[model samples]
Target: MKKISILALMMVFGVVANADTLENVKKQGFMKCGVSTGLTGFAEMGADKKWTGLDVDTCRAVAAAVFGDINKVKIVPLTAKERFTALQSGEIDMLARNTTWTQSRDTSLGVNFAGVNYYDGQGFLVSKKSGIKGAKELDGASVCITAGTTTEMNLADYFKTNNMKYKPISYDTADQVQKGFEAGRCDLITSDASQLYSLRTKMKDPSAYFVLPEIISKEPLGPVVRQGDDVWFNIVKWSLNALVTAEEFGVTQKNVDSLAKSSKNPEIRRLLGVEGKMGENLKLDAKWAYNIIKQIGNYGESFERNVGKGSLLKIGRGVNALWSKGGILYSPPFR
Candidate 1:
């Protein structure tokens, strides 16, 4: 009986000791990040089998912060219905897909949404020849939309409120919807405006398509991790916050090392791991933010590279701009 009790106690201690995600990641040597199966300009595989996009950047940034090497990440492509389950089942360390933050998702899904990295809204993209001026005009149109997304619910609400009747051609993937819409099986395609832009870019005649002017629902998209892991949650949240704060402080990847050496700003110093115990608090090295910035760059830089003005997506930073610049992209102080 005594031996059995001792063994049971040891097992419990071992389980508790291994529960820290930081420790687990260090032992694993790579962080597993969940991404959309294929959302161009957001999360997709390139010809070289390398992942790139705004969502991919988030995963790389987290990896950089953790292992000091952005390449030390494994991307697991997941569909909308499978993203949450993948995270919850421990199949992925974190999810960086463009998933919306909803109340049910936050509370009932056994996951934690770190923060909103992108402020998006649902909209309709119609062919220019369709002569549909706006979303309000799609009263009785056949809409192609993805299932298991806020787009479906929003479409229902919008049509019901307007007393408009329509048929929803729902699919499980963005590619399916794009193919259906392109085949002329549906009169319109509805999705996040950013997604619509990406899909249109891939269209046979990109110039022939245009997104409607009406913005439907607020879609705060961000990274997600499993619940019951506060340490991992804080690490992910603050890693992203560090990027936003670095941009606000004019700390780019090219200059983060130099700024770390001589920046007199207390916040800058703390953020770059120059003067505070911030990294230690999160069980990371003092140069966590420095690695994130030097390797991944600030949020603005990532956005521009993946989805903003510089990319083929050509999206303007409307609500995604900094808070000081009349947008809602604000982060808490590094201190």
Candidate 2:
């Protein structure tokens, strides 16, 4: 009886120890990443059947860190309603779908937010013809919102706090909300300011819609991972951190190769895996971060290429800039 009990205990410990997600990813030969259905400049499929955007780059960075090849990821597009459920159910390895980090979501859901990739805020988008300059003007106006998202509660709170009332026309996806707004189903649409800009560009006349200046609630959007896998969580978290750190050190894709071999800066050396066990600590190859910088790019490069001045969004760095540049973006030391 004692031998049987000891054998059973050993079996349990074996199962627990073998639950490393990184090992599973390697065995499968590819990483599964969840993205939005089709949010322009965040995650969208182009005419060439390729996914390109800020969120897509996040996925590629993780892939490069693990496989040394960015293309070893399969993009799984998910709606806001389906995203968390998919992660919880193990349908994807990680979620880089521009999801917000909130208290209730962080604690209640069986998932963890890696870190804030985009510091955003909720706002309203109205047509120029409405002659409305602010969100407070629409007391009784019908508002279009995406269902099963934080926007629903934000809209309710904003109206109630101001002693106002409005009709809510909720939809399943951002595209549906955009279609409803364009079809005159609602007087205005409310979403993340960046999303509003993306949606406006899809309109017949992008200049006709104007986003309100009032940013209602704080929405620090980032990637997510399952709850039990601390190893995988650390890998994803630091992969994002590497991007910001690389940019802070001026290590772009164009110069990462030379820097890896010749740069003498302590932080840069640790980051590029030239003088430390940073990669080994994360159970990755020594050239993990070097691969990410060489293949995908640093954070600023991804932002500029996908949604900043280099893209149609033309969004200023604003609060997304580095901490040294008067923004909140700061990475922990590689040491």
Tens-place lDDT per residue, model 1, 22-54, is 778889999999998888789989999999998
Point out where model 2 deviates above 4 Å: 1-18
Worst 10 residues of 1 by lDDT: 10-19
User: How much is the lDDT of residue 100 in candidate 1?
Assistant: 96
Provide the RMSD of all predictions against the true structure, rounded to 1 decimal: 5.4, 5.3
- For 1-335, candidate 2 gives per-residue lDDT tens digits of 44554423543565323247799899999999999999999999999999999999999999999999999999999989999877766678999997999999999776899998899999999998999998879899999998888999999999999999999999988889999999999999999999999999888899999999999999999999987789899999999999999999999999999998899899999999998899999999989999999998899999999999899999888999999999999999889
Per-model CA lDDT versus the true structure = 0.89, 0.91
Leading candidate by TM-score: 2
Runs with alpha carbons beyond 4 Å of true place in candidate 1:
1-19
CA error at residue 261 for candidate 1, angstroms? 1.1
